[model samples]
Target: MTEQPVPAPGMFTLVLHTHLPWLAHHGRWPVGEEWLYQSWAAAYLPLLRVLQTLAAEDRSHLVTLGMTPVVTAQLDDPYCLTGMHHWLANWELRGREAATRRSGADTGYTEPEALRAFGIREQAEARLALEDFEVSWRHGASPLLRGLIDTETIELLGGPLSHPFQPLLNPRLREFALREGLADAHARFAHTPRGIWAPECAYAPGMENGYAAAGVTHFMVDGPSLHGDTSLGRPVSGTDVIAFGRDLRVSYRVWSPKSGYPGHAAYRDFHTYDHVTGLKPARVTGRNVPSQDKAPYDPERADQAIDAHVADFVEVVRRRLVSESERIGRPAHVVAAFDTELFGHWWYEGPVWLERVLRALPEAGVPVGTLSDAIDGGFIGAPVDLPPSSWGSGKDWQVWSGDRVADLVALNTEVVDTALATVDKALAQAAVGSAWSPRDAVADQILRETLLTVSSDWPFMVSKDTAAEYARYRAHLHAHATREIADALAAGRREHAERLADGWNRADGLFGALDARRFPR
Candidate 1:
């Protein structure tokens, strides 16, 4: 008898999560609308282009893309579109300024050739980004994303509105947020996502039931959440909802605490900036090197690094797939997850690396697919009980609920409790009286502010110490808005409540179609 052939290696899933706090009409410089526009120009636009190109070539379902409802709202907002256009135009102007200053004596450039090349490259990129924005992104990103989904080029994963740490949210609010978030995605894309990115990949026991009730078939979690056995997607306890654990061995190859491809000496340094033009001009010369001592960026050098890194990552995935499959005595699945913004925004060359990897994986006999496809392809594992966990530090809920952010946790509890109570009372009164409608604007705004206050960004920022003050201020501001509106509504001051709602609506307005009636009474 002929010897039986060994089965092929297991499949790979790349999960890229895209999210940002509601930034429209927020501050512009350093960390607000600027953050949104920068990421849009540098990351979202390029990634979309790559995926669309692949779709044109009949290569579909390249990766699983998660876009949160809050970020989607901002992307589709008219105000943000106009602002992004203006931001792009200004970027081109800055590029021109850099080019003109290249010949100046006080520019502090030891290499004139590199300076000139940087200027020309910056100008070209800015012009191209502007053109792309005008032609494709002028109306909104929803249509572009919808087309990709329609073509099956990606499996979209929707998440909660405002990206709250679900494990910490009140159960009623958690369900309300998840339902509303999915509804919002359907409204925009005409598709209901079966998978959720589960804000921060955070999970708690029993949350699977919530996901099941909300129609989510699968969600992602950290590898440790599965007892370090991330070779297969497992069902949560007895729930039918599946949880795919991120394979950190593969993911950390690209990014981790101690090392990552982004930290290579040839890659553009994210920290150092050219004060004159607000552009990054240096390469990461060394980990310990000061910004002033860093060498100028060389595109050729970065391209070589990208090629090497891409090859390295492909080999890593291939090895892991073969090893895990043999160990499990069956075909195993490897899921590598990442923050979408890390591509063009943080690492600059990340988009190029991604494009190459997507193409190279298939050539190496490693099948790449989305999490949904993995399950449909028969990679399910035994059920396991997941502990309270997140993709944050320590692989626990500490980043959002730790001692450093205890005040934020307390603030969120107080705000959510107050908002829910006020809204419930108003809904009851409306049912009893014929004059009031179920959809009260005051109550709606209150819930909106409450959701904003509970965003996991506040605590993450506080713990990480990056823009902590702004994060705290934003949380408190929304909480204050919720409280003031609730108080006005309680006092029978309809006019005052309307005024307060109108003001906060203009400032913190997102999810324009949200109706407070969706909340559980």
Candidate 2:
């Protein structure tokens, strides 16, 4: 009799984390609402379109998606919807200007043909994006996401409000944030997520208890957090919650410091911009090449590169799964996690590559499923004690709490303590009441500002030196608001507190349903 062929090794799950700071009414250019609109138009819209198409074709749950409550709130906010629509219209106008204008040395586009081509492409993209927005996203993103979840096109992972680095938050505050964040999701989509892409994938020794208490069944961590053995999801000691490690070998294939698919010579250079169009039009000809020296981006060449990279990635997954399964004598699990924004926002062709990879993986005999599906499919391993870790530099908290951001760490602590104490005191003073009232607004604003102040983005910005000034300014701005509101509440100046809260709410308002009273004294 012929020997039975060994079944192809375990499955592959692609986890894409979608997050951004609350940017509805924040600044407009450089690092504000523009960031939100650009990503919305490029990444979210296109990625969702891909998933929806796959779902229609009966290929659902091809990837796991993580959308933090903060980002969800912004996506659903009416103000943001209107703003994004207007921004798309403006983008089309900018494209028109680029086509009509002449390029100079300062504009980075040396070739008129290249500039005109980029302009036409931009105009077409903007018009199509606007049409999509008006047809599908005019109401809000919640409905679109809800339909995807209902169809099981993706498993949604919710995160804490404002994406705080959980390891450093006070335990009570941590629990509060997690509970509230989950509640926000349920309110929006009518489904509570069981798995979360922890902000920064940061974890501490005792967070398992928090996960258990919050009813989370699983979460993602760095591969090194599991000592490089990512063949299965391990249960945290003494808890039913599972911790899935990202397979860095597969993930870094797409993005890494030294090498990544995005750096291909034919791919659009993320850093090189056409000043005339305010858009990128050059290929990454060679590393460290001057912007002017780069070659024009060719769509046909980039399409070829994308196809080649997708094949390479599928093979990487197959080899990893087969090797790990043989070593362990069972089907192994491989998860490739990446930030959702990296797709269309950072790498212009990422969404296309993702759609192709998802379709190609199963054809290559490697099945694609969500992290939850992996656990249910018997990829769970023996319980283990997880170390304190994050998916940051050195696989630790250095990116958020290193010496480079010591000042931010100190500032966060002060702001959180003050806000929690003041909110508790104010709640106690108020007479017992029903769900929400004016008495709760001060405490609500305090928590909102506090959450904003402790966002992981601040330290990340400081460490990376990317918009460090804006990050610092934002941190201090929220901290200042938190302190002022807390002080007003403490001084029994209810009117003053209301005014301060109102101004801050109008400026940085998100999570309108947040109740500060849920926090412990």
Candidate 3:
């Protein structure tokens, strides 16, 4: 038999950033912890299945997985673990109840039978999710992810605790956060990350120095952040720490946050839900069609669409890699990064599509690997001085510090000042300690609240008009917590500050290695 030559000479790296702001003890129903539980069940669990299957096949370096410390803290917290188990059990109950639910006669343009069918499907899905959670994630996410890292199935990327928008963060606090975040990863997985997802892929002109200081070898930014030439990872600010840009042309071909393959007419409609069963029954019939008039979702039809998309995406990557290699005079590199939650949480069929694409890419002569492989394989380019940018709108910092979230911007500034000053004062009054040693309780708690307040999610949510009210409330809540503790410490009310710290620790505490002295002198 004649041997077929390889189809392309390039590399494909898929990076999935898994993050959700710390939401363990927050609100439950409409948002907050609900988001955490849903994403865990829908996206994280299914995502683990996909990667786990590949791992079973002895696949190594399948993708790059970014796990933020803040999110990690929540996933491993005792409270969150208990809550997740309960949530999963309750989901099974809800599904069981819904399976026999009757649709209201006034159920706007949908048929009653479709709603019942969705309920039946949800019952089965919920049961499987619960079983998976029990068998795998019952302890925490650390063990599952640790196994992946140990087996080389995925390369882990660590980021700043709380996912603060580094460009907007104070340098001292930013440095402290990054160090603490890396330390957190080391504690959980026993591996120090050489790369980070860089919180929204946000970068500043001099931020590479921070990456260098924290021992980060590489991080990701948007394509435009690298001026649209993303064929290679470029060294930034003359530092050994490299910056890889997400290839948007190849990435957007799969999906973006608001659109892409997920918007196909044959796929499950994310926004259209059956209120009676708390299940999505509709397909994305048409862009102009109202939710009430949408057609029922069909798994078989979605699978067909997924197969078509998998083939198209593989072809697109093949062409891009060949053209880029020819243009750059080297075997070109492409990286497609997305939110891990986008898979099963936002797009119901996303996991299926992911598994399909990952398997198909290799068969199509595209070598799928992680970012670490790209760098080690010598995909380095010339140094580029990256401007202050993010993967957000305008490929700049607008989504975080723009006018829409101006109030949050101000709140963060004030909170940081108060927390930093209070910590400095506390340290001056007390005995000096090493960076790793835990300082005063009040100071540490204040820092914790301060870090949570500055998380990039708040401002991003506000700017995007997604859970805006909740974002505002959380920013103010964390800010207020910082001020309350800081004021108590300032007045020499040591007892009051300690008590406040104790009370707040029930909700805000995560990083046990967090020391107040590390923030300043």
Candidate 4:
């Protein structure tokens, strides 16, 4: 058989999104705040530290962090900041208690030796805070993100205030959300974002105009969204917006929902629990085993798997880059995008796998660059309009507003509209530059309420059934804030608006520069 020659030369781009919804003022004990804290510590903080370290070494990460407005708001929020400090302290206490349990000889497990070993390991892990808490979370806005952006180590991309699945939203609402989100990004991050990450990677037929109006030039879509056979960015039907499709072949090599690398037997079991102590204690068993019965993680075995996967992924990327660049006689870009949480939140060894991949890519001579660089270079051409689609189930919006989440979407729409209207009236009556105007105070509070209300986390929490109570509480808190601000404005109680705005700002410390002019002219 005649051998097929190599294809065109191309590049590889990696985009990682970092976001988490408002968890402060909601849940903090046992389940609620713990989830938030762990993610902050495990994935977000560590990821940032790693990136920063890379930057110091003059290593170009070629990564983008999509700080959704809602997430940024929460991160910058004073309430969240204070809450996180307390949460970190509580974690340290937990670690201490775990250490005591390990040493006191009071753990009455049937297998004392095994129980002792587990306790000791757990205690050690708990006490180790990776980086100092203050240094990890630091001031308002993720310290890591703020540092990276300020240093130009990463190109920051912004998203809607609450990451609302815009494609399904009313066009006006979508426009409003995008406008507010981008403006908020500029105010908080102190940089204008050139690109955006459509919440859930969701796009609709005419959403490009919404993006364009908001000043976003590019976004990402699923591989299947491009008819399952392409990897280039293309235009929607009638706009200049560029929609970059994921290279599923390469992406699936790392994550593919059911068939992804996370399902590997050597990986930690994400859903197993200890029958004795009620904590997650099982290891990753065979791939086909029920999650409840997987074996404990074997670091040795997991390391082996990581090495194999990294090698396989490098080859996949290398061949694709070389052949694509050769095939089209122009450098082609193969973008592999994935959720940031998948690295450590869902896949236990994901962080390790990631480190391996990052280190291995350069060694393999496969040049890695950010999506923006690819666009800046000749790898991608003129912008194209994208069709309505998401990287969700069936490459649509089922996961976000599916049968189970549809009701939540309706509720979100009404609440967001109600909040926006209240803010509009307040802005009208307030002095634009006055720090103490009643109307302006109300306007800002209303904006805060709008943000907390639109957090996509609420619907996601309810849909996932992880922490429904916390979700419900947060949604209601925003609703209440919105209603109270509106009532104050209607009654011409500028005093009340001023007072509430102060308190709300203290509580909702996000979007420090939320200007009301972003609304329609």
**What lDDT tens digits, residue by residue, belong to model 3 across residues 1-521?**
86754868879999999999988788997988989989988898899889999999998899899999988888888889888889888877777765676663554436667666766888898889888878888778899999999999999999999999998899999999999999999999999999999999998889999889889999999999888999999999888989999999999987876668989999988887666556677899999999888998788888899999999999999999999999999999999889998899988899998898888888878998899998899999999899888999889999998889888889999989888888887887676464344457888899999999999999889898989899889989999899998999889898999999899988887897898777756
Score residue 407 of candidate 2 by CA lDDT: 97
Error of 3 at 310 (Å): 0.6
Candidate 1 is scored at a TM of 0.97
Per-candidate Cα lDDT values, in order, are: 0.90, 0.89, 0.88, 0.68
Q: Could you give me the TM-score of model 3 versus the true structure? A: 0.96
Q: What ranking of all candidate models by lDDT puts the best one first? A: 1, 2, 3, 4
- Model 1 regions more than 4 Å off: 1-8, 102-113, 433-438
TM-score of 2: 0.96
Alpha-carbon RMSD to native, per candidate: 2.8, 2.5, 1.9, 4.7
lDDT (Cα, tens digit) per residue for candidate 4, span 1-521: 86643333566777778777755555566565566666765676556656777778777745777777766766666666777677656655554444344332322223333334544565565455434556555676555576687776677878877677776665655677777778778777668788888787887777777777677887877877776534466756667667777888888888876687877777767776443342333456776677534555566788898899999988899888776666666677888888888877777677777767877787667767766776677565544545567776667666677777676677677766776676666555564677555425566667667657766677777777877777767777887777777777778886886787777766665666555555552
lDDT of 1 at 447: 85
> What TM-score do all the candidates reach, one by one?
0.97, 0.96, 0.96, 0.84
Weakest lDDT window of 10 consecutive positions for candidate 4: 103-112
**Candidate 1 lDDT tens digits, 1-521:** 86643334889999999999987776987889999999998899999999998999999879999999988888889989989999899988888777766453444444445665677789899999988888998679899999999999999999988999999999999998999999999999999999999999999999999999999999999999998999999999898899999999999999998899999999999987767777887899899998777899999999999999989998999899999999999989999999999999999999999999998888777788888899899999998899999999999999999899999999999989889989998887777847556577888888889999999998999999999999998999899999999999888998999999999999888877778877886
What's the CA RMSD of model 2 in angstroms? 2.5
Q: What is the lDDT of residue 193 in candidate 3?
A: 95
List the candidate 3 regions with Cα displacement exceeding 4 Å.
1-5, 102-104, 107-109, 432-438
The C-alpha stretches of model 2 lying farther than 4 A from their native spots are 1-7, 102-105, 431-439
